[model samples]
Target: MSVLQRVVKPTTHKGKKILLKKEPQLIEGPKKTIFFKGRKTSDKIRHVLKDMYDLKKPDGVMLTKRNDITIFEDVTPVENFCRKHESSLFVMGSHSKKRPNNIVIGRTFNYALLDMIELNVEAYEGLKAFESSKILLGVKPCLVFNGPLWEESDELKHLKSIFIDFFHRESVNAVRLQGIEHSISFNAMPDGRICLRSYKIALKKSGCRIPRVELEEIGPRIDFTLRRTKLPTPELMKDACTKPKELRVTKKKNISTDNLGSTHGRIHMGKQNINSIQTRKMKGLKKTAQERKIERTAKRKALTESNELIKKKKVHDD
Candidate 1:
């Protein structure tokens, strides 16, 4: 006696699909002996069968002829036919020269073999060599083999659209976007000195114009440059407003007294000595207001006394 096992879709048989409750496990224990029976053996089918059973060519399942039923060499053609019709079928049998027995044929509705093949093709093309090797070595493949995540998900798609819009919006030339305007202001002083100031200003996109001026030409000139907008310190303003001291030039009158020889000579020498002393005192007194005022008062008193002495001496001589 012999037993047969098959896997198939459910729709063709009008039954619910056999959902794999758990992943299939490798068969354990002492290998149970089994045999294959068909009218003929095919190298292609034999190779696939060997791979499935993890068997070397010399130690694979045996194939023998049977007379009870006809057998096909490969089941791939039948599988393809089922896929085209949106159906599925599976068949298994034990064979002998006298009669074939223990035959099992099944149909399914859920499994889409064509879809599985397409998915495998995409994964094989997409996965890196290391990942593909792991899968070939019996590791479960992850979502890394799937297509672009942004193309597949709605949220990512929306984000991508927004990013594109932000980067690709209409652009304007940097020069044209900001306009330019020039201005000059002039102020005339009481002494007919005109202060002419020129500024090179930049108008920003926000409609604000900032003035930039040259500071070197700020002194007395017909066409002077404006200074930067920094406010002057109080000390600097005070220094500017304070007037400079006026330069004073003193006049000396030369006296020619004619007593012809001795008296006038003595007087002339005495007057020179007095003038020298007064000049020294005036030079020393220049820094103090009180000292300068007292010196001027003494000069006026000396002049009045000399005039009185000259009038008395003239009346006595008369």
Candidate 2:
């Protein structure tokens, strides 16, 4: 006879417990990104990465040392780095004769690479090129995607989502009018290149209820041509997109909104006896025993009089 041995994992170590145990948070922290360069990089790629890092601000990690890793071939190093830093997003800059001025943007789920898109930086500009007041660090910028191609293909849709996620700093319930400081817009042209434009928002007095809005172009204008993409599997995509129960908006039954912004609801109820229902006890609404008796007596007298009239009418007819 042989006895089977079961291996049990240990949880007594302090460091292990601290590393493994994740406390549930009511509002999770903003997603952090890892910005790094590949073995070979160009001036344009470095500037792009630096500018993007500046945009990401306090929630981003910038690694100055070059890492020898290919994004499409082996993502193991990237995954390890992400796991170590607890980051969910990454942008890698690389340059080579084969693929010059290449930039890759990707996001992770469970510290694993979920999806990534590679783009060739066809044209580039930096912030120093424009003479305008830069947006404050940590201020969220409004993102705009102006192109029908964004909706035409799954790849374009994924790219749009990636861009939104990358630039979007934090989740906010409401934004004040004064908080609108900057905006980033992406325009996909028919030539299969995307134009990324940054602008500073200016609000002036309109002499009315609303303020007049104007956009001034800031620098760091980039034109990208999409090259390679690694999309997530359907199951992985679904799992990544799934929201927690607390975050989901539970639909209220029989509740609807009208065109005028009025909320309406339909209440279903069983048959109700109004007479048996208890109402407020008040002297004006209540009746004494004598009053109830008098009412009953009047009702009986009226019924008897009606019967007598009917009998007299029958006799007259006869």
Candidate 2 on 1-318: residue-level lDDT in tens? 995958556577985676455433456667889999999999999999998888888989999899999889999999988988888899999999999999999999887899999999999989988898888889889999998999998888999999988887767888999999999999999999999999999999999989999999886899999999999999999998888888887879999889987999999999999989877487777888998999999999999999999999999999
How far is each candidate from the true structure, as Cα RMSD in Å? 43.9, 5.3
Once model 2 is optimally superposed onto the true structure by TM-score, how far is the C-alpha of residue 241 displaced, in angstroms?
1.3
TM-score of 1: 0.14
Q: Which residue pairs show backbone clashes in model 2?
A: none
Worst 10 residues of 1 by lDDT: 115-124
Q: Pairing residues by index, what is the TM-score of model 2? A: 0.82
Task: Quantify all predictions' global Cα lDDT against the true fold.
Answer: 0.32, 0.90
- Give per-model TM-scores: 0.14, 0.82
Which candidate leads the pack in TM-score? 2
lDDT of 1 by residue, 161-196 (tens): 322221121233443312322222343234322233
True-structure Cα RMSD, model 1: 43.9
Clashes of 1: 6
